[model samples]
Target: MKNQAYRMALLYDFYGDMLTDRQKEFYDLYYNEDLSLAEIAENYGITRQGVRDVIVRAEAVLTELEDKTGIIRRFHKMQEQFAQIADALDGICQLNEDRYQDDALEGLCAQIRSVLSDLKQE
Candidate 1:
């Protein structure tokens, strides 16, 4: 999945708990299929502008849900921090002829486990 789309899908999974039928269909088509508004409009037999409006409203609802609940934001922040730490650990793993490299890698690996555990608890 595209990165933005993946984030949007997570947002949907969180916010979709509250969408109306038409709103859910619109969001699923636009984000999941990579479809253009015009294409979705054609499929639904609505005007392009009408499709655009519906999509915009749905996006707003999703955003509102995320902002209110903050689950998606927390998930994104955790992923980013985890990636950075993983990259740092990879750099440490590359160090040669150094005892500290082993220590660093072990510490980072443990930190990664901690992060995963915390997320699971959440």
Candidate 2:
């Protein structure tokens, strides 16, 4: 709705498999081809309001799926956490060369991997 590329991509990936055929057609034209609602309506032989309704409904479906299946959301959170851990590990490698920190990093990486696996499971 707000036209952020990353958010749009997440919504598309999460609900891409769940859309109806007509919804998919409208979505592809609007999202993938960057078509305006008026253009989509004209190409699909529908009114602009009809195109708007289709897109709104599709977005609702995607939001509902994301709410129900938090794999995508959790995966995003995990990615951020992983990035932080990687940065910390790099700093540790440079600043603290010791067995204790190495063990801690190993444990942290294991936990991160477990979180990634949980997200992947869904």
Best lDDT among the predictions, by candidate number: 1
The TM-score of candidate 1 is 0.59
Stretches of model 2 off by over 4 angstroms after superposition: 1-5, 96-122
Each prediction's total of clashing residue pairs, residues at least 3 apart in sequence or on different chains, is 0, 0
Off by over 4 Å in 1: 1-3, 76-122
**Candidate 2 on 1-122: residue-level lDDT in tens?**
65565676788887788999888878878878889999988887889999999988988888788889887888888778767766765666555455455766666666766775675566
Whole-model lDDT, model 2: 0.78
Which pairs clash inside model 1?
A: none
Sum up the clashes in candidate 2: 0
On the 0 to 100 scale, the lDDT of residue 109 in model 2 is 64
Q: List the residue pairs that clash in candidate 2.
A: none
- Candidate 1 global lDDT: 0.79
Residue 48 of model 1 has an lDDT of 88
Question: Which is the leading candidate under TM-score?
Answer: 2
TM-score, predicted candidate 2 vs. hidden true structure:
0.69
